[model samples]
Target: MVSFTASAQYGKQKKADTLFNKFSFVKAAEVYKELIENKYNEDYAVRRLADCYALLRDVKNAAKYYKKAVKQDNVPIEYYYNYAQALRGVEDYKGSREWMRRYKDSGGVTSTKNFGKDGNFITSIFNAKQQYFLSKVNFNSKLSDFGAYEHNGKVYFASTRDEGVSVKRLYGWNEQPFLDVYVTEKGSKDPVDHKAKLKGDVNSIYHDGPVAITKDGTTMYFTRNDFFKNVQEKDKKGINNIKIYRATLKDSVWTDVEDLPINNSEYTTQHPALSSDGKKLYFASDRPGGFGGSDIYAVDINEDGSLGTPENLGDVINTPGAEGMPFINNEGTLFFSSDGHVGLGMLDIFATVADKDNKIIDVINLGVPVNSSKDDFSFFMGEDGLTGYIASNRSGGMGDDDIYAYNRVPLLNVEGVVTDAINKKPIANAIITLLDGNNRQIAYMETDEEGYYEINIDRDVDYNITASQKKYEDDSESFTTKNIETKVTTITKNLELNPVQDVVILAELNTIYFDFDKHNIRPDAALELDKIVNLMLNEYPGMVIRIESHTDSRGDLTYNDKLSIDRANSTYEYLISKGIDPARITEHQGFGERRLTNGCDGSVNCEESNHQLNRRTEFIVIKMK
Candidate 1:
């Protein structure tokens, strides 16, 4: 016969475990509380109940039970680790660190290494709980046999289920059906099941499945081959070279299927991407001189629509394994799918920064939830950068390679304008920037000709806007915005220009015209001198102003210099006689037979009007105070 106390304890323990197994963690915790209330197997029940609460994300109760379990002794290292992780999840970083240290001190080790071989710490500080997966876009069987790309509120993909003139052929032994390019809007209730076929020479006898549409949805680049036309020929090696072709949209129809020059007679080139500006072309090539099997290459698009010679993107982007399907986001971040790279799945999506010089840097593997053990490739990121679409063959998908959507945290959008303060005139090409309080540049852009600029900024940060130009003092303004909101602000400011000072005021000696070179101011010259007196009284009422005179290149340099000085002195005396203070006027210097506005060698180009530019009297603002 069972002892009464032992049987009662056994019954309570069984009830707690049963509730825990059902995922009713709160109920299980209550049962554990009742057992502990009676002091029946208190330690075991408490620890088990802590694990149940932790599974339910009740970290506070989990920590309490874990402490109780440790006090009772025989508490495993996993219990402490779980408790520490729970504390960290609750943002108790300091306490969590202490517990983790204690757990390690108790002869415990983390199962995975914290640092990568590159010596960089790999743990994500961002809470994974804050991330979410959006709804999966299910493509029915009629539309499932295609690859899709979204642009301008439309999804462009390729399909060939008796919707075209030519019968499509299966490319490989896996017997995947060949396809032709098609397009449909985003919010169609019917899964594009019976949409009209895309018009153009988009389909051929061979496979033309994979496609990439430019941001404007006007241009398209797709992969196809001429193999089927020459199938009866003997030599087979040259027939399988799949090449990419470009098409233009004209009059609501795609015309001019032109083969890109980057395609060579020796190897295959496919999966082309045109930059947003349509100036750079990125594509995958299996030609020789590559780093590995297939490498990404880029070519400059000339203004006349011809392509320059292609250059390989080096080993940073390409690896020993094939690095294909290169897609560049609007912010110039590069996303591609590779099988040779180490990742969570067979073929995973990787991201890297594409620098201005077209070099790849800081390659990162997109971790779990985006990548599974199955093949996941053909990724496309939206213009917003926070939403992404990827094609996958993972189980539970709607088709062989279904599309999945996920939320991506976007780089913030910082936009503003620059204008003249007084006139309110729009200043074009004005450089504007947003900097942190520490003066680090967070975002920057130059205003367009219309005096407008928009830049994407990271969220939850403060920044100062700095605007500057030639002949203007730098302007710095500060602003902040809530996360995920488009901020519109304006900066209207005036640039006060400093006047030039210490400039010489020059009078033409020819205007003093004496009787065949006399050294005195003539009557007509005295009238011009009176004009100077009036100008001095009006502009520089109290300042000391200097007068200087100059002669043409005809007279002797020394004699004409003295004549010029006498004429200047005569003019200064007249100004002093006109009730102007003698202290406010000064003696003049002369430059004779030199510093002529025109070259002295007498050419038709040296006209008198040209000399007028040099003959003018100039005034400088000396001291206002």
Candidate 2:
């Protein structure tokens, strides 16, 4: 009947602090708000309440509290960090950057992490063919929802939905209805809206979800409250921790549920991601000795359906920030979300490929469409790879966290190493050229120190990759990227550039064509000649190039000889003008109609390509002084 604040009951302030310490943030916010309204410990109350909102990922409310507390003294540097993250989510770039600057100035935090890498990674990701963008789920509710995994044609995930049952009520953590695992009905009009089955045994009146279903659909690995098995464990802060659990479906109902061996009540272990074969289990934990708040870990599944010891994914995949929601694709590539690595803001999704030895390899941030300034996590890719699902709290979402369908248009990871064919060692600094099926230049990059080069390619396209070095023979490979069933995404274009032999062909230019009955160099012909000029003047200065020009057998032999001579002289003069010494050209001879490459020597009806092949010029190393 009356308004009461902490000033009216200062004795309860310690109780509020205790509740906050227990990570019961929603309830703590209420107490802190009361204290602030009554002018009791207003500064700390406003700041602490704001921290709770930020931790809960309520960006707008966090921003509100930050605006009030930013001017206060003795505020933690993370407050500035949270302020920046929250500002960016609300489209306040200038404010966010300024707050980022303050966070840097006020004892800037650095933990062996590349803070700007994620933002830069986004650039290249978008520059490559765009493939992943969020599509709002049709059945997203106004409550928190996330972590959708597809199994048996239905998607199983976690959600906070209302069921109008009192005993199945609120969780003090977010003040939402107890989180439960839900699944979409494959035959339903809208699967996301379908009530999930196997709830009672597998789910508790506490948080449950983001499950990993085995290939057989008989076993499940999921996360739920630690109290599910009467093991009510809490951290030093008194907040109940989460544990990973495994269960089996008996008679179409999940009957047996048990916690994994690696789960600890003292910290937290949640977000289960399993390999497609169910042999590898990846999850997030906040246990000590981690790089930061939470780190991604992996455990091998034994042949007997038990877990191996947990292994940290190391510094590459796990940073000093939170990393969760690991999803391993069909090819064993690991996809997870991290806040430790520098990203657009908050948590961003990243991927790491697995080597043949089944060890995790290079981690890459999946920039732009999959990541935003707002928190984006809970990524699941279907077997087809063309479509998947991700969970995010970015702007324009249906709820606190909504599941969005991600459709990848056509993208693939193309990688290879340039090695000397003779030595079998990686070639460093080899120039690599990428061309599409139409022979149009796509992109170029040099090999790294280890002779490794990787690039993103649009799928369903035939690509030609040419690798060249000054002293090595140019090598090229034709790559056809088939979408959907593209397990060969990481194409090993392991090019072997053999050293030039005595009779060297420096530039293997494709059919250098001339215009009909013409001797002058066309644009395509000039481009090819330029490459020869470069080889002669810049690369092979000591070699003498004999430019031999030929024409189709369509004209008189004498006239053809004269026209071919003109063509040879035109190419020679162009090379000379481009700084290739006249001495380098030992001879510019015209072969006329005598050297027709094919039987289409005016004796048979042939297509233009055959005729063009005959109307060609080539440079050969005749003498190497």
Per-residue lDDT over 228-273 for candidate 2, one digit per residue giving the tens place of the 0 to 100 score: 5655677676678899998888887885898789988798899998
Report, for every candidate in turn, its global Cα lDDT versus the true structure. 0.62, 0.78
Off by over 4 Å in 1: 1-132, 140-147, 159-168, 193-196, 214-217, 227-239, 354-359, 411-625
Q: Give the 10-residue window scoring lowest on summed lDDT in candidate 1.
A: 113-122
User: What TM-score, computed on C-alpha atoms, does each candidate reach?
Assistant: 0.46, 0.68
Maximum-TM-score candidate: 2
lDDT of 1 by residue, 214-268 (tens): 6666777887763333342212343456678787888878767777778764687
| Clash pairs detected, candidate 1 | 386-408, 412-456, 412-457, 413-457, 414-455
CA deviation > 4 Å runs, candidate 2: 1-12, 22-24, 91-108, 116-128, 164-168, 190-195, 228-238, 353-362, 410-625
Error of 2 at 555 (Å): 46
Candidate 1: residue 522 Cα off by (Å)? 71
